[model samples]
Target: MSEAVLRLSGLEKSYNRGKPNEVRVLRGVELALVPGEIVALVAPSGAGKSTLLHMAGLLDVPDAGTVEIGGREMGGLGDRARTAVRRREVGFVYQFHHLLPEFTALENITLPQLADGATERAAQARARELLSRVGLEARADHRPAALSGGEQQRVAFCRALANGPRILLADEPTGNLDPATADRLFDVLMELVADEGLSALIATHNLELAARMSRVLRLDGGALHPQA
Candidate 1:
């Protein structure tokens, strides 16, 4: 097996711990994603898919477990340190495109670099290269409003890759698109994972998409389960 780029061991998360209305969102969940592997996290609604993704992506903390990326455990890290780790090692994609309305596609894609203190010029160059890689070179200067849903999503995919994150946590990346568009966008996503050698854990309800990944894991009953 490959060395893991991301690992979750004995992971647990809960809301309102030890009080009335306490609910465990994830329990004893264990998963690992190695470099260049794309795995699917599938489950029905209310099965804690998003909650688990949040913890895995470092957006939320686990109540009683550990999340490790690049060999660093996040269980005891402070908020600032965790944010830095996420910025350097993880990229996240949401269902919504979430592109900045005020910026062009290239600018929106490069925004993360500025947050990390990179020069605008350097970021722009990387962003444009990504745009080209996604076949969006001509759309670089267009605003999100001028793009189709699929185009906007393609830009978002490029944006997620902007920082060269070791792992990506994508939540329903193609959920909002039409079936045809969804398949196209999913292809772009998988191609990038293969071509760039990045690992990914993508949460989805699409079984066909899940089947296309290196492995398919179903999140059920607040735990990670491998599908046969």
Candidate 2:
């Protein structure tokens, strides 16, 4: 069996601690993602799905428990170390494409690789390859403003994978697309994930999409539970 690429154990988080308006988010949540597995995170709004993802992706820390990637614990790491580990081990995709309007699709993808120490030529080559995989090779030179919503998201996907991360954490990646566009982009996303043998934890409200993943974990009542 594939080893766990992500492990979240006994995690706890809250806002406005010790205040009347405080809201407790995660409550001792635990989750594990094995290599090459794609897991869906299903949760209603205000259930802290994004909060959990933020902790997992190292963008934020929980009040208690641990976040580990590839067997390395992340709780006490300093900012620079955490940033380095996150950059090397995790890729994040949000609901919005968030591509830079000034850069071409290929450049948007290439920039991440370059930031991660890849040579310019290598970055460009990888960008082209990823764009081709998503059927965006012909749109490589077009900026985000010139592309359709689906196309922009495809570029975002390419950018996420540019650094060869071991795990992907996506927050409603296809939420803004129309049903047909969402379906098509989802197929492309899964294909890319499978081809790379990477583990993914994706948040989505679409039950149909959730059902297609390797497994689904629903976040409710401040905890994670297997859905069927």
Highest TM-score among the candidates is held by which one?
Answer: 2
RMSD of each: 1.1, 0.7
For model 2, residues 1-228, the per-residue Cα lDDT tens digits are: 766899999999999999999899999999889999999999998899999999999999999999989988998899999988888889999999999999999999999888889999999999999999999999999999999999999999989998999999999999999999999999999999999889999999999999999999999989999997
Evaluate all candidate structures by whole-model CA lDDT and list the values in order: 0.90, 0.94
lDDT of 1 by residue, 109-209 (tens): 88899998889999999999989988999999999999999999999998888898889889999999999999999999998888878999999989999
| Candidate 1 weakest ten by summed lDDT | 62-71
Candidate 2 stretches with Cα past 4 Å from truth are none
lDDT of 1: 0.90
Q: Supply every candidate's count of residue pairs whose N, Cα or C atoms clash at under 3 angstroms.
A: 0, 0
TM-score of each: 0.97, 0.98
Model 1 vs. true fold: TM: 0.97
